[model samples]
Target chain A: MAAGEVSSLEDCLEEHLPPAVLQHVWRMLYGKDTRKLDLPKSALTASLEKDFQLKGFGFEAAIEQLRQPRVVRVGLIQNKILLPTDSPVSEQVAALQKRIADIVEVAAMCGVNIVCLQEAWTMPFAFCTREKLPWTEFAESAEDGQTTRFCQELARKYNLVIVSPILERDEFHGDTLWNTAVVISNSGKVLGKTRKNHIPRVGDFNESTYYMEGNTGHKVFQTQFGRIAVNICFGRHHPLNWLMYSINGAEIIFNPCATVGALSEPMWPIEARNAAIANHCFTCGINRVGTEHFKNEFTSADGQKAHHEFGHFYGSSYVAAPDGSRTPGLSRIEDGLLVAELDLNLCRQINDKWAFKMTGRYELYADELAEAVQPNFDPYIVTE
Target chain B: MAAGEVSSLEDCLEEHLPPAVLQHVWRMLYGKDTRKLDLPKSALTASLEKDFQLKGFGFEAAIEQLRQPRVVRVGLIQNKILLPTDSPVSEQVAALQKRIADIVEVAAMCGVNIVCLQEAWTMPFAFCTREKLPWTEFAESAEDGQTTRFCQELARKYNLVIVSPILERDEFHGDTLWNTAVVISNSGKVLGKTRKNHIPRVGDFNESTYYMEGNTGHKVFQTQFGRIAVNICFGRHHPLNWLMYSINGAEIIFNPCATVGALSEPMWPIEARNAAIANHCFTCGINRVGTEHFKNEFTSADGQKAHHEFGHFYGSSYVAAPDGSRTPGLSRIEDGLLVAELDLNLCRQINDKWAFKMTGRYELYADELAEAVQPNFDPYIVTE
Candidate 1:
């Protein structure tokens, strides 16, 4: 991080909060990633160790030794709605930019190397209204947009790998639009980008009304800190989506999402953890907080023009380890940052232990899925 | 159900359990299946409805209306190890046979239409030993195996659809071995078999040393109750395995596994539930109970000749609905039966609302996965 940026961050901190409270908040968020602050052995881990003991010949000691050192600190920022639904896109983007800048300084001070923002973090989740005119204003060029430029400055200032998810307008490609996550490197470089591959058509997400699913095959962005992948939002529900990212050798994958409690809370707690376990990697699931009420009533599946507030955005974000244990909800109703010191080496350790990828029988499944994706594929072969 | 089978089941109940206790046990396991029982609104159902509201236009009421009829009673049996590890395969087989028969009688009295056994239920999970001779003794022909034949009679006697997972030997095909599940219909005939495609190579499971991964593409068995699929044991770790089963129209997919708490307990609770939500199906994840102590010390990755048991086969079996809500753990230690009344129509209802499968962009994923399965595929197009 540059001296100028560090001073600016400190200056902002000094101006915005009291020294005592700022110190406490920074410690609260960055405390674990500081490398000096050791976390207590989780009960789940002790139970797993004791219960799955390799006894008689005493191999449990070896398993314990394997779990030490080699950690990567990742920070997940689940932001709340930063502006009202009717705010101008420029003002909305500016407000979120300032908020995230403050967060990035705090996250960097906390020693977080990687920080991820929620999906479409700059503007209100106004897609629930099914109105086109105003929300379209939020879409900007992913490469040169003001939002990406703002993130670049933060990335450079914090020496952080920032995953900034936004509604993108591809001006070079026929003005095409996409749900994209721009990966900004520590050197203020745009490393690459990943688009949301699976789009939802059900309920409040008539996302097809805005943009189609992405064309990028499963992609992993190779960064200096770690190899990372982005499975934006609805893609989390697709197991294959998660599998493909793992197959691409991602040690840490972030799911930047904007889902409501009523829309997918039951599945919210299940999919990311399972993907982390099954794929032998660390997964951070981040969702935005608060509710967005629509002014206009829209016709929906219930055959009525009805007004509805978008379901509550639960924002209970957490990080899951390769071994399947996850952090409890960080903040269910408030904006918060969740950080963890992940031993990136744990990915290899768990993979070596589980060998899920090696034993995954990709060839067999590939053949089956190859046939399955055919236009006339049959789901069942019934024999009388 | 056939009159003879009903009468025999009644006779067994009359001969063994008293009327009051039997009724209580029946209600405990099978109450949800009996439409007349009028279950109090289930916490799982109420939670799911509350968490995944179809908002905007009040269509959740219609979804509730859709969930009214169309229920299937399925039973999951996570049996405890019934014999010593060093015991003769025949003795072990007989011991489990009697135990399973007793359990099946209880399951029938409980009104379970479909009952599934744990993976290779007739014998010990001795694959961890990496020794062939004794474990090979457990292998039998899938078509005429003693285990299948045993289950055949039980299925006929109970008028039950029995899914019997076993170590299969194809005698006619050069005695090739497979981890297989044989689906026996209510009439006591072998419907078909689905082989476990994904084989484990990590930890205690060097399954490839005994049997290669199965070549059979995903197949669903159409039965009197509903379409079913079996993803035997290690296949549970692969999400694509579960997805293929769902795409093949499996309403109830049974994951009969032998995973221990040490190796995958954290994952056990998460995977099947997520698979249920992602695939829009009912999933039963069953594991064996008790410690299967090995007579010989096996060499494991921990660099020691270990006389370790294959960890505790934590029998925390449960059922997950399509919308991702799940039943509580049946038993973590003792052998028990978990029965759930699945509204099979919920698969379509959830799919209709989520439209995940319908809008999954199978064509695009198929093209990518087809390329991905090639011998020389790479996940990144790296650039400087």
Candidate 2:
């Protein structure tokens, strides 16, 4: 503050600051960088409107807000758990519990606000052979299940949202099992559940034996951190599912899958990435790694090895940006968490840059597609 | 022949047959069915060796002794021309006449083969800018220049292969120039070309003032009832470029393009589809999409667009098989023809059952790609 001496703060702002620099400044001024930036709701109402012009709009303001230094970090625990029939049920549950605990500890150390487990993470993928014992023993009720209690305890300890998927036994129905994903809040409360929509019975995998298609439409739950949507396995293939999640105001969508190899190995990433690109939302594809074998092998018509050797699961877990660029060097195998300091402003940046959502020919094929999905619908029959 | 008694020719060979039965068999043997049917070498080899287990290997023995087919139709065309420019007179002449005609008449269409024309079939794509005059004098080169004369004479006289692009001078390419395409057959007949690439310049529409990109590359040329490749303009964006042609080998590869899209667009199809799903033998891309412009606009950076609105040409035309999947698509649209046709049999059955080749890694990167062309390379690079 001497005469003829340039002030450091004034010099920094005047030296043609880059957007990143301005963002960091905004973060320093505001404790929470994204979504909590102090500004009038509209430009007309802003007190220092001229100074606020540099911030652009709400999404940009949110990104700048998030860039502020904060301790809350999140990581997802994506893994595949398969229980062989030969193993005792008690022993399998104990092993899974330990694994879950270890992953939660890792997340806590990384300061992750949430750690999402893969779909049906505790049970082995047993639908391949329609075996009765695996389904009967593995299915659990979300309300009173041992797995739910275990996850709740972990969430309380780590102070994190723990998303757990299970084979839920429906009490109201005729004891039918549902492919359900339960979201446990930081304070250890069951937020609610979403059943998977699409049930695939293609090739060797037959999921219909244990679980029916999810009836609940897409839902986004508001947590302390942000609004998030949970899409279970197989639902990722359908674009409409992602759209429904986006329309519900989800900023981030988590897709957890338990798919094994053969032709499917290549298609795993495509589903999640497409959802992100098309919806302009950040997407994480958490897949279960490793392999499992079933006691019985189904035979194909050609007498070939029909039951997949618990299909070789390639663990190419990744995080994709709204711009469709993925974090390279992500591990294809081995258990590790991939993290990136994402500038959330990129969501809108990409949206404005590509404008795919706005320009998309949504109405062109909407009617034709609706007819195709609905049952017994005939467009050719003109009822005037 | 007595009632309840059957006189069979095969029975005569097995048991002691009467002379009348043998003589009657001999008389029946000299019928039209006794002669073998002719088929293509690939079809016959595939049927007998793969399907029927035939033993003969030599073409003559397979045809005469084993009664297999030998004919396998193929076509080859070469293009050699530089994008037209108002510099280095000798080089321009060589490009227009000797070098280009040598490849077209001497190399490609000498035999009864299919041939393709280079991009811009006439002058260079120098109209990438706003300069007038150079493009204003465009003419029906297919009728006025040596290109048409050579093609007509070759097709009629030698029963040669021919496809030529010409500058159809009209109200379009400014006052007189029009981007045109012409397809010719072995009998020296014109098959007509479609004008429609519809070049859109986000930063520079210099092309609108000069000539338009052709609209169609969809038509299939037929000569001697055999299909041929006829991709003109920038018709590669449509996947139908390969799908329609590959439904049957049509037994040739021909791509003629003018330059001016993002550097990546031209290269994507040039390199990707050649190795696409099935490995077809003989694939070529001809280009006039190179650099050269007059001086209405100057003072731009070297290789930057001049006020005259033409760009400097990059001439790299290539012929490849399914083997080199990584070869970058040709860069620098120039005047050149790429010619090669090994055997249609090479692509036929191999790509039939194994759809993997056609499918390529489409699913792998399908969801991961945002804008096919990014202004900056930062997103695709691995920063870590």
List per-prediction Cα lDDT, in the order shown.
0.73, 0.49
Candidate 1 clash pair list: A71-A343, A72-A342, A379-B248
lDDT of 1 at B266: 59
Assess candidate 2 and give its TM-score to the true structure: 0.52
What's the distance in Å from true for residue A329, model 1? 2.7
Cα deviation of A318, candidate 1, in Å: 1.3
Off by over 4 Å in 2: A1-74, A80-84, A142-144, A269-271, A300-302, A305-308, A329-333, A371-384, B1-384
Error of 2 at A149 (Å): 3.4
Q: Across residues A1-384, which tens digit of lDDT does each residue of candidate 2 receive?
A: 012212122222324445654443332221122332232244223313221111111123133553552222445554445355469876777787876786566556545676777778777776776677855677788876899999999989988887788889888788888898888888898877778877765544577767777866666777665666788877665555666676566667788777754435434444565566657777777776666666678653334766645554545555555644443212333344443344455666556544544433333223333333345643221010
Candidate 2, overall lDDT?
0.49
Across B1-384, the per-residue lDDT of candidate 1 in tens digits comes to: 011111112223334455655443233222222222222344224323322110000001123653465657787887776667788878989998887887676667556789999998888888888889888888988888788888899999999999999889999889888899889999999998888888888778778888888877788888888889998888888888898889888988999988865567657767787888889888988888777888888777766666657777767677777766666565455667666777687788888878778767766666666677788987763321
